[model samples]
Target: MDPADVLNVRFHYGGEFIRIGPSLDYVGGDTAMSVLERDKLSLPELKGFLADHLTVKDSMKIYFLMPGRQLVNGLLFLHTDEGCMQMSEHITDAGVADIYVEYNGEQDEPEEDASGSDFEDELDDLMDNDDEPDAVITAEEEDIVQGNVQAVNAVPEQDILEHILVPNEGGVVTEIISSPVKHNIRVDALSQGSLPRLSRF
Candidate 1:
């Protein structure tokens, strides 16, 4: 049989703690797997690597859902073959198989109504509702928006900016504005350089 065709399987590792859920990723290959009882890594040379892990005394072999042809789409190919080995070992150790698997239960999908009653009711409600969203805003909010352009142009020099925005509580938050005097002086200096005799402010 094709390896990929083997979809479901049981695995075992001598340990407590069992975890089972929908596989978030794919695994396969060989490494320190308790199933094969080997410390060194080796890809399961044969399916018996899987069967022994499940602890099947008789012909009751474990089944495994092998990687499908579209391994890329399934996001399984990236996993090292050893990754799968480790995963199976982990799941079996977690008592994933002991929990019991109940088959024949399928999720029911939402069904649409044959009549248009639900659609008509929704349409009528829409027609009856005349409320529009409110346009409430504060004057301070307007000032922030209208002043944003001016504020952006007022970016301070690297040193002063760094001092103002020092890290607090082990995290950094940008300081929007530094000392008013320093800011003004910087702005003035950029616009007008030092003169021979300038009046002190």
Candidate 2:
């Protein structure tokens, strides 16, 4: 892909977390920490930075060097008050423990009204129960009705892709790997930044 063609990309971000994906130029043997080291970041300081300042809310986009078949070494760019900084490596690690916070963007169509009118009446009964003065609730019942109200309680998806690794201390990334995606490989936690909101495109 032409470097210019990659422009206009959208990043997903929330309060702190940002949305990211594997770049188009992932090398076969790269990790978060390794990239950080390559960039001359100090590992110890990087750890302190993450501990001191990092928050991963749901829907935060994080770019990573995808292992295996899909890998690339595309420029991972971030917009900041100073301007844009395009890193040659992918964002390997984040402070938040959750690696990926995917929401139901395109849900599977509800099992085509399998219960028909009976389903409708059951749903109505459940709705009426919500108004009951003191209705006994069970875990099973809650699960059954999750579809009806989960969206209201669902966390809003992160809407920006730009992030900043504000180095409270400053350090480097050594390794980073997703277990399900890459088994037994301990991916390093790279430096964390204070990602500001901006146009990822």
In model 2, which regions exceed 4 Å deviation? 1-57, 64-84, 88-119, 122-201
lDDT of 1 by residue, 1-201 (tens): 432323233432222222236333223312224223324323343245544433323322222333332222332221245744543453332232111111122222357765569988887887789998579779999888879968765766554431244444757553333454454556665477632222221
Query: What's model 2's TM-score?
Result: 0.16
> On a 0 to 1 TM-score scale, where does candidate 1 land against the true structure?
0.16
**How would you encode candidate 2's per-residue C-alpha lDDT over 104-134 as one tens digit per residue?**
2332234655557887879887977856567
Q: How many clashes in each structure?
A: 16, 42
Off by over 4 Å in 1: 1-35, 38-41, 46-80, 92-201
Q: Model 1, 157: alpha-carbon shift in Å?
A: 99
Among all candidates shown, the one with the greatest lDDT: 1
Worst 10 residues of 2 by lDDT: 26-35
